[model samples]
Target: MADSLNCSSGNCSSAQEAFGLSEGHFALVKAAVLGCIFLLASFSNLFLLHALWKRRNRRTRTQLFLLHLCLADLVVAFFQVLPQFSIEITHRFKGSDLVCRAVKYLQVVGMFASTYMIVAMTIDRYHAVCKPMVSFFRGSFRRYVAISAAWLISLAFSAPQMFIFSLQEVEKKVFDCWATFIEPWGGRIYITWITLSVFVLPALILMYCQIKICAGIY
Candidate 1:
């Protein structure tokens, strides 16, 4: 019985060591992946933006949306992915409270902008296909309005992130950028709201528009 207990303890210690090692490896992999994503997104978006600019005179409404989408994606690549990559490499956020809050705010801004831009583009397509006459008459005005609304909404919605996140001491002196919520309920409600806004609502809108588009096509 004593021998068996000793063997079990030894095995547990070994398993813990293995787990720690694997976690370190995972962190490196995550950093590498994020770096690749940032690079690819930046390069591709910039190239596309330049191409679009060259054809500015002949661009369509869809192309305009795409141009803004690329801008939003570049924001994600710079503010979101690049910061995350740096955090992964450093193993923690290395910034002041204001910097942390700004990063968090811009991160969500990019997400919101990207999501709503897609929604706007899809709705534009829906209008073009299903309500061609209406689209033709009001397309220019509505296109500008949709793009502006998407950006304004993104900025407004992301404001909370700036207030919620700040640099805090996680250890004796080691600080990290963390979000402070009002215990359990705050976290849950905030997450639910984010999910609904960023994923669920947009998904539903996209789905509805796509269905209508298909029906119109048929």
Candidate 2:
């Protein structure tokens, strides 16, 4: 029985070691793959931005909104993508607490901005169809306003992430960076609100507009 126990212990130890090795290997692979993807995406967005800028005088409202969205995505990809890639490559948390907070902020802001842009686009489409007499749709100012509002709303929503995220050093002395609101119950409430505000509300709005548009056409 003692011999059998010794054999089981050895096997468990070996398994753990293998798991750790696999984790490290996976992390490295993730870093490489994500790095390439982000690099390409960032450059592509930059080129698009440049092209749009060169033709700014001739830009339409829809085009302007799209350019803003592309710009936001590019910034997020440029700033946060490399950091995430580094985290995956090292697999050993060496980043500072400040950077961890920044990462969380970037992630949230990116998402908020992107979603807002989509919402703005939906609203723009609704306006174009529902209020065909509105000459503003043909003008570029409406798009500029939408782009500005999208950024403002994104910043407001992302403000919470800056306060929520933190860095903790575990028993193994490795730093784990994560975002968690300090308030337990409030955090849940906040998440619920965010879900409704960012997702459910927008989805309902889009659906309503789409249905109305379709019915109008019919």
Candidate 3:
């Protein structure tokens, strides 16, 4: 994500000229910043995944949910961030239509799936606290189902990105891949839904849970 932001940081060529930085210098700066981000995120997620893997036998369903969360984040870091990092280093986004679509698809799916995983975690907590007698969440099978559904749902929501983006030439024989949604209102509606699902729905759910807990305590 940081890599994407940096590469798409307001006209790269213009920025270099204004700042008097060479392509190599810009690439180096990008490498340093993106390298740090990827290193920290990848290592941390890997460590967590490893720890969880070792304790797999002892893990509860919640632990599995957390495990899925980490996996989702790792997916985003790898697909969304890593590809952009490579682009910055190469100074272009030269790839086939299939690769461009796949990269963008995974990036969007991973992002939304990560948030959905968190929402799943929150729902589990809500159930545990508010409806203690419901023993429906103990099975590992349910965790598998939930995680699968999260990815599927996210993929459904993010499918538009695949068609909305195509590789466009940015420099001589060099290309940059970005979303060029043909339907402006369609894009706006999709973005609005994404915002609601990722931000509003989760906030409302968490808030409701908090209110329930407060009421119970009172």
How do the predictions measure up, each by TM-score? Answer: 0.88, 0.78, 0.81
The models' CA-based lDDT, in order, is: 0.85, 0.70, 0.75
Write candidate 2's Cα lDDT for 75-148 as tens digits. Answer: 57865676667666665445678877777677767777878898888778877777776735463566668778
User: How far does residue 62 in candidate 3 sit from its true spot (Å)?
Assistant: 2.3
| Stretches of model 1 off by over 4 angstroms after superposition | 1-21
- On residues 1-218, what C-alpha lDDT tens digit does candidate 1 reach at each position? 21221121112245446556565566776678899999999999999999999999999997999999999999999999999888777878888888989998999999999999999999999999999999999999999999999999999988989877878776688787777775656766777888899999999999999999999999
Instruction: After the best TM-score superposition of candidate 3, give how far the Cα of residue 67 lies from its true spot, in angstroms.
Output: 1.1
What's the residue-level lDDT of 172 in candidate 1?
88
Q: Rank the candidates by TM-score, best first.
A: 1, 3, 2
- Clashes found in each candidate (C-alpha, N, C closer than 3 A): 0, 0, 0
The most accurate candidate by lDDT is 1
Encode model 3's per-residue lDDT on 91-115: one tens digit a residue: 6675897898899889888888888
Question: Using TM-score as the measure, which candidate wins?
Answer: 1
lDDT pick, better of 1 and 3: 1
